[model samples]
Target: MNESGNPSQPVNVNEYDASHIQVLEGLEAVRRRPGMYIGSTGERGLHQMVYEVVTHAVNEHLAGHADTIDVTITADGRIRVADNGRGLPVEVRESTGMSAVERQLTELSFAPKPRTGYWVFGGINGLGLCVVNALSSRLTVEVHRDSHRWTQEYEKGIPISAFTRHEESSGHGTAIAFMPDADIFETTRYSFATLSQRLQELAFLNGGLAISLTDERPERPVRHQHLDGLHAYVAHLNPYPSSLVHSPAIGFTSENEEQTIFVQVAMQWNTRPPGEFRSFANSTRTHEGGTHEHGFRTALTAIINDHARRQHLISPDDEDITAEAVQQGLTAVVSVKLAHPVFEGCTRTRLGNPEANTYIQETVREHLAVWLDHHPNEAAAIIRHILNTSI
Candidate 1:
């Protein structure tokens, strides 16, 4: 109590100063907040670590360096990804003063070249490899380039040894093997089904790009590859002839030079109930339909309605066909590649690029209109089916 009999103010035990704050260097920040980088520490995050590494290889393929990527899950729960791409550059980058290999492994802000129409690379945020390194118990990278093979090793994101050069090698590529840290992930073992499904999607999305996933845990290893691209994907989803109302799926590709956008669509009407409408932006699946999907729906509905009206299949006074009605008994795959894609969230399940809406709409409308005109009989059948449902 004070002499004045009033309550005394509490004393400031410690002054606020710079010393109170601590700084985390290297990949320590990633370990501290793993979710911010990989979304979760559960199975999704574990699988995401694998995806991050594979994405780098896929980017190399897109850059015209590689043609095939091989992903294998070893018996010991380690993941090894190898690509026949022009290996990672061994030269030191002036900005960071670290070799490309070292910077990619240790630095969080290190980024490759910006994506362009020539190559639709996926890892734009630059957190891929570093995040994988930070979350792995051990990581080893080998690059075969310039007639020599170079190697480096790291333990939980820290360099265990300096880069070493090996005997001359003829082939060129990059290989990364990593074991997820048991302390960071809920589970270290990976699901073969999940990995295969994702790898197949990547292969389908990038036509001519070969990706193989192999499981070595089983007595007889299982391998999966898809080469027919989206066409095969649509057929795989609806395999039975009884399920498909159309014999052959309608597929097309279109590109906009000005917007630097490329879109591919494969669709077929089925006898079974309406199937899924799968969509992707830059190889990432968008489960929640965004501008790209919206554009697709708009184009489908508009084209169908216009064709029906022209063929006198519907009364002139009838209301325009609803998007849902147009999509009934429809199975479709829509993939778009753009240089600057604005995804809705970190999960990247939705695309928000406004320009994509216009580009996709125009492309679908024009190409589909011509198809409908050329195949009058098939177009009439589809219109009739839709009209019957509308009634």
Candidate 2:
């Protein structure tokens, strides 16, 4: 045995040579370390695969190039995502000598190219569709664009069929279908309920964009389209209709001069304690929150305290209502769309943009104050409920 108390199978220092080094080409790296791209081999990672594909379609909707998205869990255990968007470019690239769609599915260096004045959540890591292609045992992409249909098939990121162009039969769109590689994932099965909730959330985040989820196993399909956007989201979060302090969720939308930053806010007070608070940056849920959430909480507490003092609900000598007290029964959703959003944390679940903080604070303070002034009865009820609950 070695002094380290090991197996002592071999002690050849020269054997640790350069030949052992491996250079994974194309999507090979993604197959080698799946977790680094998708987060895990568990259910969470499985869902992330769906998100990566869906987010691509959602980006099209965000860019005003698409309005409808469809996701299906096939009876054969495959997944399909389709969108009525400007389908992927089919022309060959001069630099790579490969069609744009083929390169996107086979290479890790290609990030999604959104049109100018638009923002997207995917492709930040430049993996995008390539990661999905690499991790899937089988993948097929169908594109309808410029009065023609293009189709390609892949197996574990390698092209198994020629890229074929056929006669045009429908409007422009993109569709992708894949079977998760059992060797790379702990399980290939998916939860329809998990997918439904997220697709519904996406529909709410992108108003007027219809998103549908179908499970071919049961042949059940559900669709979500919210014209009211975050207002609908806030109402959905507070399921107890009778417990609301306000009749409808207070909602507003604001944008900066360059139109680079857009903020949408919706909030409602409820009788229930520990109400939900959700925040998103460029359609990505900020689970851990960050500067935008901080700005929201700050503005909300200050406005409520100021209003309470003005109405003599609390004396000048009396202690101000604490932030915890203010949030006791508050349900709110804050969504910020930044041209260049900064995210932090290992999971990339927090917005870290400093400008987001200032913009959110000013926007919330201005809009919420106007809302309170317009709905004096609701404002009073909300404050009273907060005071009663905090006691």
Scored by TM-score, the top model is: 2
Error of 1 at 376 (Å): 1.5
Name the runs in model 1 displaced over 4 angstroms: 1-15, 93-97, 115-124, 219-224
* Candidate 2 segments exceeding 4 Å error: 1-15, 116-118, 122-126
Minimal lDDT window, size 10, model 1:
115-124
In model 2, state the lDDT of residue 213: 92
Q: For model 1, what is the error of residue 155's alpha carbon versus the real structure, in angstroms, after optimal superposition?
A: 0.4
Candidate 2 overall Cα lDDT vs. reference?
0.88
Question: For residues 181-235, could you state the per-residue lDDT of candidate 2 as single tens digits?
Answer: 9999999999999999988988888899999999999899999999999989998
Residue by residue across 76-158, what tens digits does model 1's lDDT show? Answer: 98999999998988887688666889888888877777544533435436568888998999999999998999999999999
State every prediction's TM-score relative to the real structure. Answer: 0.93, 0.94
